[model samples]
Target: MKNKRKILDWMLLIAWMILIFTMSNQPANISDSQSEGAIKVLLLIGIDANSIFGQLANFIVRKCAHFLEYMVLALLYINVAKHYFTKKVVIISTVAFVFTYACSDEIHQLFVQGREGAFRDVLIDTCGGVTLLLIRLGISSIKLLKLR
Candidate 1:
């Protein structure tokens, strides 16, 4: 049963990685429309998505999506890592792999038509993973304090 749980964990991680790859492989226009569609939904909520703000909204939504993708990726990764390593090892490995994957994902984008890789995006992605790391650390610290 424990072995099965580990397999399930890896399957989920692989599936999410595949999803991110597929999204990144989309053509530029399709990707833009995706973020724009999100803005449209926000527009329905009566938010000011005027022409100028629309541009800003698009940028924010796009960057947030990148942040959120790797954030969830890090969360899944740490879960699997905990099963195979010590606390310190898991923390180190989680950040290392998440950052590495983020770098590779951007490189992958460079090959995709209409997609250009940017270092800034990689930083944004790393920040997302770090956000999860920080949150998890805080929770662990609280737990330790309570136990003491």
Candidate 2:
């Protein structure tokens, strides 16, 4: 079971790194006459929902995306720490490490051609990491309860 978890953890880490790299390197698509693409499709749908919901949908999407990003980062963090430490220590350290990465990721965006760092995004990203940790805790608690 331990080895399986470790292997799964590494796989998830690789996937997360790929996602982060892809998202970070994504160029701004700025062409006046350009037609539709997948991002455009999502934007159109999101903007339409935003119009109807008055920012709620947009806020939800942004939060969810941030949360997903951080959850992956947290998993990667936990994976690294588990090899060298206790679960509690691993969780705490991973959260701290991921929070720093979130800050750096935002700051790095400031140098991108059309990107600017926002403190709110950083907070959202951290919240995502925390949220994932809580979920893991919740699952563990539930399992303990079942065992008892």
Top-lDDT candidate index: 1
| Stretches of model 1 off by over 4 angstroms after superposition | 45-54
* Model 2 lDDT tens row, 1-148: 9888888888887688677656754444431112223234567666454455554654555556667878879878787678879987988887787788778877876776676678888888888888888988999999999998
How much does candidate 1 score in TM-score? 0.92
Off by over 4 Å in 2: 1-8, 30-48, 55-60
Q: For model 2, how big is the CA root-mean-square deviation?
A: 4.4
lDDT of 1 by residue, 28-49 (tens): 9999999989888877887656
Residue 23 accuracy (lDDT) in model 2: 71
For candidate 1, the lDDT comes to: 0.90
lDDT scores in order = 0.90, 0.71
Residue 118, candidate 2: C-alpha displacement in angstroms: 1.4
